[model samples]
Target: MTKLKVAVIGCGSIAKHRHIPEYAAQDNVELVAFCDIVAERAQSFANQYGAKAYTSYEQLLQEADIDAVSVCTPNALHAPISIAALEAGKHVLCEKPMATSSEEADAMIAAVEKSGKKLMIAHNQRFVASHVKARQIIASGELGRIYSFRSAFGHGGPEGWSADGANSWFFKKELAFIGAMGDLGVHKTDLLRYLLGEEFVEVAAFVEQAAKENSTVDDSAVCILKSASGIIGTLAASWAYNGSEDNSTVFYAEKGILRLEDDPDYSLIIDYKNGNSERHSLGAIQSNEEGKQTTSHVIEQFIGSIVEDTTPPICGQEGKKSLQVILAALASHDTKQIVRV
Candidate 1:
């Protein structure tokens, strides 16, 4: 089997912490190159992974043998980099919050179609053990028609993840767009969509700059979504939680209420209407030398898609659908009214 050659753009925390290590672990993929505007950071990644380093994405895209590129760059650069890579005849795996706007996402989809190359978005929540199990339960009709629910993803701030802290692109409205909504909300939004197996029809959102001494964008947001299936839910995301990472989801159906969380052994709890409760424990994805776990599942699936010529679970269009919900929530926040998703 011919191994897929991968060039990862951007050597930031997400790239270093997840993408690079994940791609490296796949047996059929080679970490061919790393790129970052900060030359030294890219050099460091190259040294650590035994790959070449390039200061420019264009230079990396020029590699004749490169089969795929991961867009681990900031929000603003997502579309441009992915489009360029796709046009250069390489498959693209872009990080979530697919792009800053719907238009950029549309352009990316067009480019992917024109290039006839695979495009997958890194929505790792779908691969998490608990979420995968939750999806299974819903699909099995055990939930008995998911009617309404609520989900949240929150953390103290980007201090631990963003090297530049308040000055990080996450704090800048230009680069990161709406702070918590894009950073954290996008994940929960995507997870919700995947679990419900429905399309969000419209959104009404309330976003605020609730934390961080001074910031142009919101630090927290709560959104209400109406799905095409008539399911309703509230999605909350925050960077000002001032607590440990809180990622949880609850589903209320005619049969029961199902819940899942990151903590407490990563299990899904179901309370059925007959006054019975069930708990399903999920096995965690084994970690690699770098401690990267199931988040690497996307990399593995992407490589499989390359080899098998099949669409990965989270394809480019599926990614954009989730992004559209986040973008609509932002628009709703600005206009103070429900916006069509």
Candidate 2:
């Protein structure tokens, strides 16, 4: 088995904690290069992973032997960097929300088409055990006609998570574009669609900066979604939650209700009208500092798809759908109307 040569474009926390480590863990994936505008950061990441460092992405992309690259940069640079990698004939796995807007995502899709390389978006939530079970239950008809859902992702703020804090790119509208909606909301949007196997056709959202001072983007958002199947739901993503970490989803169906979350325990609880209740714990509680699942599974899946010439479970095209929901929520927030997804 020829190992895939991989390069990481951003030496940020996500790339450090997730992408690079995940790729390094894979036996058939080699970390060939690391790139970041901050030279020391890139150098440190490269040294940690035993890879070469480059200050510019162009330098990394020029490596002829690199087979794939992970674009872990800010939301603004995802499209351009991923498109460039795809055009350079390397498979790309970009972090979500795929880009700031749908047009940017569309251009990435175009580049992937032209380059004839696999492109995947890293929506790690879909790979979590609880989420996968939800999909299986819904797909197996155990949920019995899914009608509605509630999903949320919330935390304190970016300042606590990153050394940059409020000054971090997450707080900047130009870098992150949107706040919690993009950082947290996009995960649930994609997960709900994946679990229910439906598309979010419209969204009515309320986004605000409730707690964060001097924040240009939203700190919290409550969104209502109408899926293509006419199933309606509410989603909340916030950076103002004064709790530990909150990532949860509830599904309502004609037969029963399903709960999926990881805080208290990795459990799926179900309730039926017959006064019967069932609680399930899918014990894969390996969460990162940000409470993200061990995303190494997702990275491996993407690499496998490229190796096998098969579509990834969450390919770039499918990844765009999740971002579409979040972006629509932003539009709905701005207009105070239902925005089409």
Candidate 3:
């Protein structure tokens, strides 16, 4: 069996904790290169993996012989780096939010089309066991028309999760684009879209920098969304949950209520209107802490897609749709009115 050569761009916390280790564990993958603007960071990862290191991503793309590259840079660089990697004839697994804006997302899709290579967004929430099961149950019509939902993703802040700590680029609007909405909220946005199997058609939002000091971007956000089929929901993203992380979602359907990631033991709990309940102990959701490494099915699915010559579960277009909701939310905040997604 031939091994797929993989390189990681931006040796940051996410790449170190998730991408590199996950790729290393894959029997069919050979970790080939590591790239970062900081030479020592890239060199450190390369030394650990016995791969080449480059301080310049352009040089790495030009020199490395790899089948795929994971773009784990700042949110602003996702589109440019992924597009370049795609044009260089390598498949790309870019971390979300896929781009800072929809126009950039479109450009990324164009590059994927031109290259004829796979482009998967690292929307890891979609691969969560509980979320996957919810999607399956919903698709089976067991939920009986999800009418509304309330989803949230919050933690102390990115300062604890970013490799640079308090000095992380995540607080800079130029790099992160939107603060909580881009960092944590987008995860919920993507997850809800995946779970509901519906696209949001309208959004109204209130975004603010309510918690983090010295931050130019929003630290908290609340968005009201309406799907095309008349499903309504609320999405809240925040960096002010100092007590504990709250990554939970409650789906209200005609028959019952479905709760995800809300319990300590069961990841999913379904309470039916018929006075019955179901509990599932599918594994816990991954934490946003810096050094914690958790099992993720993202790499396996990405590699499988390449090997089987199929589109990835979260392709560029699918990522774009999820991103559209976030972008629309931001627009709504800016204009103080509802925005069509």
> How do the predictions measure up, each by TM-score?
0.94, 0.95, 0.98
- State how far residue 323 of model 3 sits from its true place (Å): 0.7
Best by TM-score: 3
Question: Candidate 3's C-alpha lDDT?
Answer: 0.92
Q: Per-residue lDDT for 204-311 in model 3, tens only?
A: 999998898889999989999999899998999999999889999999998999999999899999999999999999887998654434777889989999999999
Model 1 RMSD in Å is: 2.4
**What ranking emerges by TM-score with the best candidate at the front?**
3, 2, 1
lDDT of 1 by residue, 236-284 (tens): 9998877556778899998999988734674688989999988877765
The digit string of per-residue lDDT tens for model 2 on 1-341 reads 78999998988878877888788889999887889898999898778778898988987788646999999888889999999999999999998889888899899999988999999888888887777777888899976888888888888887876645667888888888888898888888888888888798999999998888877889989999999989999999998888677788898898998888844854678887677987778765334455554654778899999888998888778988888888888788788889997
Assess candidate 3 and give its TM-score to the true structure.
Answer: 0.98
Clashing pairs in 3: none
- RMSD to true structure for each model, in Å: 2.4, 1.7, 1.2
CA error at residue 81 for candidate 1, angstroms: 0.4
lDDT of 1 at 113: 89
* Residue 323 displacement (Å), model 2: 1.6
Lowest lDDT sum, 10 consecutive residues, model 3, at 288-297
Top-scoring candidate (lDDT)? 3
The better-scoring model by TM-score among 1 and 2 is 2
